[model samples]
Target: MVNVIIRSNEANAAATALTLAARDHHVCLLSDKVSPGLYQFSYFGEPRNEVLRAVDELKAGAPVIGVVFAEGEDVQAGMQDVLRVASPQLMVIVGGGITGAVEAAEAARRFGLDTSSVLQIGAFLFGGNLSSVRAEKHDVLAGFLGPETPDHLVELALATFPRLSLGNPAAVALSSINALFHVPPMLLNAMSVERAESIRFYVEGFGDSVCRLLLELDADRLRLGAALGLGLVPVQELKARYSGPDAPKGLSLREQVNTLSSQTAALPSSFHHRFLRHELRSSFAPMAALAAAVRVDVPTISSILRLSEILLEEDILDHAARPAQDFLNLMNTHSLSIN
Candidate 1:
């Protein structure tokens, strides 16, 4: 029996399940074994049915684990529904940025979830999607957040990926390279975005200048972690950890971008894509708030949040209340472990 049943609306995160299901194959097709039309949410489309706009049912062991992987906004809005249906032994939010992870963890806390059993773990790994990044080429760095974590749960989580479990979920979230890789390209290449130009984002937009911006953003997150007494992973370090065997060590941000071109060749047609929408709120805004609470100013993060706010037409910080002191404390707690 499957120890946990992972669920997701995002193709990449949901692909985590597919990777597990098709463990032996380099590539797995849903149609190869299962009828997509019958089991999935054809109501939306195959891409989303994998996780979102619908769900799959199973009469497995009662009180099973449930994992949600989708856009942060969607996860934030639909977590209640997920809980009602899954009533899982464990609830894992797979793709929500640091903010979503914290928010979901708080919600679970408020609901009086027993961390020992019905635990909620907010985690996001860079490459869980086998479709986008092959298991061989892909890199995994999963960070988890929740109280009283059990070794069995950690093992169960590791069973889902082929990488080590990075400690302290908050540190993992703050160290996410997604925001560093995405926000800069969106703002710097706003013109191409406006034109809806079908150019490669990383290769074209991820120039030396953009890479510098990415480093600066990463620096802010690292600073926030430092202020909280946690030392987050540096971008180059994460890149090396997750990089394929052929990948070179000590790559600069630009070199890393070039190395990742194969995975990031698919670019969004508009700035209205998730890179801006998801990362800005999930990673940037939350980091900014934490930076404020810890008194570590993140001018770059702040500027991007503001720019995306104007572009997305919303005050991203308003999504969550004042940065919870506990938030900084959590980071502090993890920082101590890493220190």
Candidate 2:
């Protein structure tokens, strides 16, 4: 049996890991704060612990691999503990942003593990109650650096998620679409979001004007991808592919919303969300830095960063600067996979 250990922060990431477990694969889910067994409180704070108990009870034949990390525990470091328990023949999956991926890969190398043993992967992990994985084909990216690559691990990942393997570390890092999804909606619909009404951010909320802004940011993303020799697809195209043509099709980002999304109007949510904290930092910061490096102007991304500065109430770009420098150091040091 190909044992798999998924180190994740968001419960949805752990929940996604359980899909493999349901298929009779040995899966271990490590996370911070939240218990792995799933005890969710309702919107009105009503109890739903019975489902959790039932799940645990039935998990005897298919035991639920639930692990709750200590306060302030690092997800990647948790892998070391799992390594001692289950020497997974498949791989240990590290899910995070570009900087996180680099650090995880570096940590694995420090642990004396090879490429065949681990594959670092992540995407737009929208956190809190909003977290979800698309049933449609979405763009998730993967990266590894070594002389001898593991072919089977990549295959396993493809079998698991709708992922595209970007052979270059830089390519994989640059391909994150979280900022594109999060920043635009948060900014454009700030008033509506602040009102605390349900806004179908992707489906109904992303009107023409918002999409235009996203497209502007996307132009720079594509440019950055081109500079690094990576063929990156825009969020609009990714959504179109995921939703299928039968849904709806439009010429531009605004137009595509009518056709590309399955949701007409979504449940109400708040402006106080992870979009600014996680998506902006992970997705936009790196691109803005790279655009400067390549001499490519990215006004939209820069503008979003400034707005994010207001929302986050801190100088956030400074946080990503060190990682960008560290990434530059890693570029020359590690091995690149050709596949």
Candidate 3:
């Protein structure tokens, strides 16, 4: 059995830990404040129960499934702790945009971990709450952070996530759809969000104009991907793919998104929500920086960032500078052409 260390006890992380545990892997979930012990976790939609054990409870000598998915510092710290405690067979950074992936890479480098053992996924494969997670079954794009990741590691990752597809790390990172999907809606619906109006984020917030702008931003992302010689899928197509068998087809991108996202969330009550913070800071800003580095003009992305900064009262691009540079450095190391 593989001993897996997952960072954060958040919905996604908890659900992932439970999924792995069900697969007979001894899963240990890490949270900064949560105590170490076995906790009863229930799965909804399909009503089931699973036990999530603490990190301290992992048995010695078990093969480690070192896949981690968490926010910025949390992921780095979790990687450090896992490296210190276990002889991880593989280190997977599930999803945190390019920034989070770079942070994981840096952590692995600091520990002198083999670059081949480090993997970066473009996004999470599951979606749901802390109590339960439904596998979205999206085509998960991933790649090694360095020059070469082993075939066995690839097999293990695919075994863990059957939908996972190996690809360029930069392409995988750039495939993130959050910035293209979330930012425009949030920006357009700012006042409603601030007012705490109970509105369906995808349905009500996404008007024709907002959808048009979203497409423009997506075009920029695609161009950036092309500049790096990676063919990133459009956000609409990605969303449709994630929607599974019953996914609507031939609809406008907006219609497809609104229709497929039957589980649309309510607009956040404040601009302080991670919808803005994560998508803008971690996703969009870094993409903008990459665009600048490659001489790709992403005017729409830039405008969104500027507007988000004005709304949030801080510099989004500046906040993302370090991660953007780290991403560029990683791409350069891979010898990818910028021209």
Candidate 4:
């Protein structure tokens, strides 16, 4: 049996992995909170350096096959240090939020270490709410989306890993801001879930960059969604208005709706049907609107943010928004078209 160490600040991160490890292998979890068990380690959120030292001591007598870092920052630094000091048999698995996973994966690649990220996006999109949404090729499609690496590093961590149970800090921040666009006016007036899900399918179908941004901001996004429940403002008032060099002169929040509406007219009529008609009134649109608003400074996200509102009305900025474009370029698939 391979010995595995599951590490993270998020309670569920360790808990979820521990559950899986205990059921599958001779796995043990090291966490900041929770109880000791046949396969658990209780901790107080120790520093990365201290964690590294502990791993070193543990490896002296026994073989540690894999190290799974599930939460906190400085993940790249921590993983790298451990990789350098730990026994050569160690394989690292990073299962944190976007930044932590991205940074750790990149660092592992730099040192030529074996690693992968496990998000349940594919599973949830294809598996969850099956009765609510009809999809035929769900499992096959879900398993297809993987990391975007040219070096050919990513392999299946598992066919299905548990979904991220609690929101990570970065996810919380991104999601919070993305929720502003879905406020009252939009919800009470023109919301349409079908269209919103359609747009969501489109964007998430694109790839990692958009999805990473969404996951990193999930908590904040949901919080912003709750704000709309309070009935604070009109939906039209929540539209994003850009002020960058590409934006028309003197645009501000007050003039957001009118300016954005007029700009929508200039887009291809196909856009109105694919997005605007459907998303503009859905819960998803508002979320997309928030992403557009917060990322008003970034033209790509801004455009996607606006387009998402047009498509689903919700900010379905997760992996489905623009799957083919974002990580498709990096993936090794024949269907790498930027659709």
Best by lDDT: 3
Worst 10 residues of 1 by lDDT: 24-33
1-339: candidate 2 lDDT, tens digit per residue: 234455546555444444444445555554454344543432223332211222223333332232212112353566576565544444434334556555555666676767444555445322223123233333455565443456665565555543444355566566555556667878877777767777676676778787788788889888766765557777666555444446454376666565433344452354346655566666678667766766778888888889878866788688777666656555545542211
Residue 325, model 4, lDDT = 26
Report the lDDT tens digits of candidate 3 across residue range 13-54: 666777777667788777664554554554436666556666
lDDT of 1 by residue, 1-339 (tens): 343344444555444554443342121122122333222322112332232112344534533556665454455445565565456555666555576556665666666664333222333444444333243323444555555667776665555444555455666666656667778888888888888887787787778988788888888877877876666778777766666576766666687677663445556766668888877767777777777665778898888778888877777888644444446655554445323
The candidate 2 region of ten consecutive residues with least summed lDDT is: 63-72
- Cα lDDT listed for each candidate: 0.58, 0.54, 0.76, 0.33
**lDDT of model 1 at position 23:** 43
Question: For residues 1-339, could you state the per-residue lDDT of candidate 4 as single tens digits?
Answer: 234454444434444444344335444444455333433232222111111123423434544544444233255555554455454344443422223334444555677764333221211111111011111111111111223422221222332232222222222222222233322222222333433433222222223333334333333444443433221222222122112233344544334333432222222223334223332222233344444433422333344456555545454455333321222232223232221
Worst window of 10 by summed lDDT in candidate 3: 35-44
TM-score of each: 0.76, 0.72, 0.90, 0.34
Comparison by TM-score, 2 against 3, better one: 3
Total residue pair clashes for candidate 2: 2
Supply the global lDDT for candidate 2: 0.54
- Count of backbone clashes, every candidate in sequence: 4, 2, 0, 49
Badly placed stretches (over 4 Å) of model 3 are: 32-44, 71-73, 260-264
Model 1 lDDT, residue 173, Cα: 60
